[model samples]
Target: MDSGIGSQPLQEETADLKAPIAEPSINLDNRIPGLDDPYEHALKPNGDPWAILLKPEMETDKIQCDAWKEEVQTLLIFAGLFSAVVTAFVIESYKFLQPDPNDAIVRLLTQIANGSNATSSPASTSFTATAPSLRINIFWFISLILSLATVLVGTIALQWLREHQAYPACSPKQTLALLRMRSESLEAWHIPQVFAALPLLLQSALVLFLAGLIDFTLPLGPKISIPIACIIGLILVFLACTTILPSFQPLFLLSGRFSRDSVPSPCAFKSPQSQL
Candidate 1:
């Protein structure tokens, strides 16, 4: 009976302890301030301000399909240029392979000499190798001039394009200004290719002219061949010059939508934001 009474009192005390308690409220307004909000822009350091503007716009407006159009155009232009070069090579091969009168004369002379000089020396001895004169055609001289001119033009255009990339676009106004700048850019980008054509065309013309000029009747076969050889040598020189010069490659070739102003963001890749 005594044990039951003691356990009853302990149970009541445990129940009392388990009951919820209401504590008095205390006021605390103490906190430390952080350095600054990272989102609040005070000019985040970046190489391109145009990209900065583009990121925000891309997040808001989505459409990057226009870039595809620019890419296609660039590829097409490159393909056309490549095809032209291939065609030139084919034409050069055709001209070089064509049969000439000089070969026939050389053969005929060898046969006549073999029959005539039958005593001690063979008659074929009289058909010794003959060379043409070294007088170059006016056409070849003109072609050389054109080749040098084209090389000069290509060099100038490459330099101009390099200089155009130095300016920065920090604002929407500046971005729009680049649209105007593109006029200058186009000249820089296009002039090189145009100039390169001069040399290529000249070389092709000279190659054709020399191939067509092999006359067996003309005196000094060796001397005549010299001009053609020089023309061929000059063609090689011009081609070397072109290989060294920076050919035009427009930025739109990568992505036309990329301007001095904007580019598609990784997340907003589909957004087509205009530079202006």
Candidate 2:
């Protein structure tokens, strides 16, 4: 055998061995299309869940804190102003608690002048505060105290809100967990209930003041007292309706809409008359 003919079979075998082999005709993708990458990615576990879950929780905490802070601040301002006004009224009303010497001297002088001009003796004056004055002072003093108390409550609420917003230095995950815990504590302690009662306290003080004012004015006769009473009663009615009717919501719109009204929303069920 010459080299050419003898090497032909070997050359053919070499050519066969050199042929390109098919790669992975049956691969992971072949078994199930497009599932392998997700399985691998899931096993790796990225930071997406941390951001996605915690972000809303943190934002919810912030929104609640800001809303309460603003409301408390506004209530504080009203309480301060109301206290000042009530204090001014108290300053005048309290003087009636004790007999004023200056007032007595003036009354004496007036009686002396009247006695000299007329033949009759000047009638003895009662320097002591009458029942109406005592009642008036009591009501006004209570109102002033209540207003101050409201201010105190509002201040405490502000502090609570501030403390609620505060967080320890920590990682984001820890921070969010801490916030949730604090919020639960806040509710558990009835901080929201305390906040809810603040307005009611303030309103009670105002009602007491008005009651005292009405009592003080009643001596002026029906001409003065009737109109004053009517006006005050009207205001009280309006305020009461406004406060109570909001609780009824879609059931009672006569008091107008509130923060949680369904004024714009259509009724879910049509009436039989409407269907007709």
Give the TM-scores of the predictions, in the order they appear: 0.28, 0.65
| Per-residue C-alpha lDDT of model 1 across residues 1-276, encoded as one tens digit per residue | 999988998999999999999988664635554433233346656555556655554333223223323433443454345445434544543443345547666766676776854334322322323232222233333434444444454445446545544457456546546644654565566643453354355445445344434332244477676776676668767654444432222333455655567644432222111110
CA deviation > 4 Å runs, candidate 2? 1-48, 102-128, 246-276
Score candidate 2 by lDDT.
0.76
Task: Give the whole-model CA lDDT for all candidates, comma-separated.
Answer: 0.46, 0.76
lDDT of 2 by residue, 58-106 (tens): 8888887787778778878988988888888888878878877686567
Top of the candidates by lDDT: 2
Error of 2 at 97 (Å): 1.8
